[model samples]
Target: MPAPKNPLLPAVRWALAVLAGAVMVLSFAPFGWFPAALASVTAFYLLLPRGRRGGFATGWFYGLGLLGFGVFWIRISLNEFGNMPAVAANALMLLLVAALALFYALAGWLVTRLRPGEDAPRWWVGPLLVLPGVWVLLEWVRSWLFTGFPWLFAGNGQINPLPLLGAPLAGWAPVVGVHGLSLAVALSAGLVVVALRRGGGARPAALAGLLAIWLVGALLARVEWTRPADGPLSAAVLQGNVEQSLKWAPDGVLPTLEIYLDLTREVLADSDVIVWPETAIPSFLHEVEAGLLPPLTADAVAAGAEIVIGVPIMEMAERYFNGLISVGSAADRYYKRHLVPFGEFLPFDRQLRPLIDWFDVPMSSFSRGEAERPLLQVGPYRVGVSICYEDVFPEEVRQALPEAAYLINVSNDAWFGDSLAPHQHLEFARLRALENGRPLVRATNTGISAIIDHRGRVTASLPLFERGVLTGTIQPRTGRTPFAAVGSLPALLLAAAMLVAALLLGRSRNTAA
Candidate 1:
């Protein structure tokens, strides 16, 4: 890399960085332009600034492009459902976006800060090794920090990338998890960068490296990490298509209950297990316990069906939880361990609440459930459970695995309105299914209720904002994938090793220089 002679080059690079970030999001969700991710990463490497401050500024702009375009739905939730003023909602969205963009700033700053001066391209260490390491590590950090917003991860783009490409990137998921796959994508992009920058056989070597990754992924896709356990169990996922605006209204409560019950009655006869969306009742469990719970239990027993319904649970005087209870062959309750920040419960309430009156979203004050709540048991096998945002955290989804015959995620995505959020959420569920080698039954309030097999394929699904039941036979799996057994530790270790190796090379270069 050489110093630019053109004064305008800096501004041009910054603009392109922003453009790169904006389009990077296109690789995710409804777009599914996985190749766009490669393009974005290559652009990022080419445009990355040399100075620490410049790198930070460039990364912030890039992040502004990515998250600003990616998570605009947050404003919809705040404005439409939270009753936040449009100006305030936009301001809050920008605030959240800017805060998250700082992580990108850190990643960008690190590139320049940790570089080996002129020798950065020596082992192709700067791009191929360092960039991927830092990128995935930072992404892993974002997944857990501030109770984490692991949405729009780099790996999210690679999962089931175009059918024409034939599962080239997704196969690495079960072996290394989402973070590891993210590293692979980043590494691939870095290889492209290195190929373009160097000559005299370098391009062919990089091309070879790229081909090896793709070929290995394609091969892994053919391997079934887990086997089927028992005959397929019929599962019915209910999507009530409830409107977010009317969900918690005092009068809307009865209507909401009826909608779910009506849907349940329609499918109860054929389903081995009936699953409901989050807070399907729109009321606390105790409120409905007397009139609904026991009767529903009896109805399920009579119909020879098991019911897993999501509702709010109130404990003692103050604690309330977003939860699910089973009414069937065996009864069990699973409270949502991971609560959605601000939506489920506000952080720094004393400071923010007084400053902003609109912080009072309905049911935004629920308490976090115990860490080790029981998995819902239906018939002979245990089902791993996640409520709403919990499924986005891979480790949280991995908790019941190796024992949990299948995975169940109950969510109310109505908060995001009619947007890519639900579809993107379905993508995340697919990743979990593929990662743990378990069939996932995803039930949601607005739409995209789906039955995803262990292979991460959508076997059956309902459309968004539609009232319907998705019934499918999910084969229970009794084994764990490498990911399920070790979680993301291996992925983290690999990323760490890349960073360490890059640092050692950089140090040696500096010492020799």
Candidate 2:
């Protein structure tokens, strides 16, 4: 019982574990190369022995590798935006990464405990179903708990090019969210590993299967997920390229209004609607009604177009909302329900008011929006809109679907500067397009303003921080995806069933013993 020591084995295991973690991190891009490669290495590492007690350590190392490498940008936000110094920012980010890594630790424990054995009652089913089930559970916890960081939710990485035929089915994520997709990706990777371990021609078959899957994906991509329905409508997305420092400043107000109007005027002739970046006006709508709104609306209407711009709207005594306004077409507004913690409004700002200036945002307090509203009608078409960070959550977009033919997203990416954050953010929106089977027209203030088709391809896009527009005909979509209708419920139910089955199987095995 002296542990049947194998020194070389321990060293090799540690090295492989570290390498595996590194591979997982490498999937984050710029930070590492080839996510699929790193994912393969990670799949291999997860197969290593942990001997029960060592499971925690194995998981922690794996998490440290996964989050430590993938979320390095957290430090960028803390230092550059939060005004923290490099060391403190790095430490805080590391602590967060470490905390998130615990989920991986939990994942390890579950994986080990749930491994199907010869005597297990549901041994035949456990490997296929139970493993993926637990993965969905852990990923769900990661998404919802702690106000939900939901970044790197596994399936998010699979977007268009991958054979992840499961993307459209995952439309339910808005209601249930990222956990479902994570389960599918984890399960797929797990299947790949299982195929490899069984050896022989299975490896080749699996490889061939993966290649075929990608081919199928490419072919599936050919299918028009959403079609140009009804009459065609022209729209223009106004890119202010407003620098973060001056966006909210008082003097910055006039320049911001001017830039938007100038761009609106330029694109107005060819468009039925023109959109401005999130909170483009910077000033509250009521305050600017006399000076800004009237002229913008009149111009848009007179020139046969509508303007949907982001601005601050006031309600009640002092309540303010980050709102989307329709100036010409319907004269309507949609408030942003999903607020950015600390950036938009501090979570515990009552106690953290003094620290507010640290975030460098003057007006950090804005109330959330209410239930879903009808799509804003401009010209002949009704457009559904989600502002800024709203596009990240699929549920928000689905709320406007069927009612709205085109999905419009307006954002200000000035804060992220030249970081992978914008690309990652755009990828999330693209996935939303694929999942929802809708055309997404994203208009960002600083960069990555893009036109995404139902297939999630960046059909047309403008370079970041450049002050210009890319005009394109957006194909309209009508039908709803399973994800769009039922949301994350399907995935959650599947995960729950897996857990229940695992428990029952374990009990039955004990009874047999």
Candidate 3:
């Protein structure tokens, strides 16, 4: 893929790789330039070394650009909300970005090692098979590694359809899941390489295949994976634009609670389920269990409504968890199954806890909740509930489906301030709703709170950092999507197969030579 040997050729390649990766970030939410996904991938794939230069360096630089620009919001959270020094926050953000970039580094290294010395690898062998296979498998690995930061996935951009195609690529979510789209996105990149490097037949074939992939996603858009279980449930998501600094303040806690109560009381008469943003109550569940919650529960019951709210709760004195609880219709409670690393709990608690004062941010020491906890029962529907970061994981969301009539995710986006995070966070929840064939109710502190339908369409929403009650109707659906029933196994298996096929043929080619 490199040009003629020259002094600046290597530097140029690396620069292009970095720039291409950054271009990929433009495809993601807040930017929503969908075609940039293909252009970025095409450039990155072509920039990959076909000669002696290592692809690993190219890949890491690419990752640095992609993740660096995409998740720069991390610095905002650390500095603005966590009170971390700006310099320290930037350093920590760089540290995380560098560490995660190793996955891409590994992907590039493996692609080179798999089929060495190939200037133009066969269309079926390397371009279509090995590249996408290795790329998305690494994405899967990245999703679960170190409790997963599944942010900035390429598929996140495809939540909307390609411009000319006029089809939502996210339609594939219900079948292959997000990683499948990752694979498809990677394969689309591979197609570009095939078209560029190969002659005659391979070029047309690659172009046709690329069109067909998006065409298939467009066609899949029509399939109804789940049917309605009940009539629309009138829901209200209470978005209290509480400042992160004052949320847990010694004096501001009660007033924050009062803000939600007043908002809920106003909307209860018009809704069946009233939802509050994450940690809207800014206090321990036990501390309020005796006094504040009882009255709130009584109010909801008297008004024929149920309220779902997020709060930190303690059990047995030592076990603290970020929790979600329903009051009035059901006393059901659910703890956040997946806790954010360093944000919710320290990674190496015994050592890391005392070494750094930064990790001591409020509500950072909570323990993980049970994975099989009971669902939040809201009136006649059982809701799949998640807190903050949990909605980003596709499998985690799938685990609650078919049985869960709908999904509710409560988050505190105030941590990220005015950043791309709140917008990107909404896209993931939108994809999950499509993947599982369920309507999603997302209530957030400092907005972009939305009600997404089963088709991954944002039906109604509140703007970022707004103070209001979002009253929307959620049509609960029942039945499983192919993805909901099988999880991500199909996508994983498909990627694994492509990889195995490439490696075996490469082994034979080496043996014959």
Which one is best on TM-score? 1
* Models, CA RMSD each: 1.7, 4.3, 2.0
Q: Give the range of the ten consecutive residues with the poorest summed lDDT in model 1.
A: 1-10
Give the least accurate 10-residue stretch of model 3, judged by summed lDDT. Answer: 1-10
TM-score, cand. 3 vs. native: 0.96
lDDT digits (tens) for residues 1-513 of candidate 2: 011222436556555555666575444333323345327433533444534445556666677776776667767766776677888878888998889888877877776666655233343344456567766787777765755666666666655333434333233233334556566555566556546444556567656755554455445544544556874556677777888777776788888878877787788888866777788888888888897777777787788887777888898756889888787756777888888776678888778777645565555788888856536665556777887777776656777777678788888777777877787788778877777777888888887888887766788888878998767767676877666777777878988887788778777777887
Rank the models by lDDT, top first. Answer: 1, 3, 2
In candidate 3, stretches whose alpha carbon ends up further than 4 angstroms from where it belongs are: 1-8, 116-124, 162-164
**How many backbone clashes are present in model 3?**
0
lDDT of 1 at 33: 86
CA lDDT, candidate 3, residue 169:
70
How many backbone clashes can be found in candidate 2?
9
With candidate 2 superimposed using the best TM-score fit, by how many Å does residue 374's alpha carbon deviate from the native?
Answer: 7.8
Position 372, candidate 3: lDDT? 81
* lDDT of each residue in 1-513, candidate 3, tens digit only: 422332447689788878988999888888878778878877876777775357799888888889888888899878877778889999999998988888877877777667545443443566678878898889999999878878888777787654565545767889989998888888888888778766767789989998888888888989999999877789999999988887888898778888988898888887888899888888888887788877888888888888898998898777898989888878888888898887888788887667787544788888888868437887667889889899999888888877899999999988888888899999899989998999999999989899999988898999988899898898888999999999889888999999998878878777887
Candidate 2 has an lDDT of: 0.68
Q: Which scores better on lDDT, 1 or 2? A: 1
Report how far residue 160 has shifted in candidate 3, in Å.
Answer: 1.8
What residue pairs clash in candidate 2, if any at all? 171-483, 172-483, 172-487, 172-488, 173-177, 174-395, 176-488, 446-465, 447-464
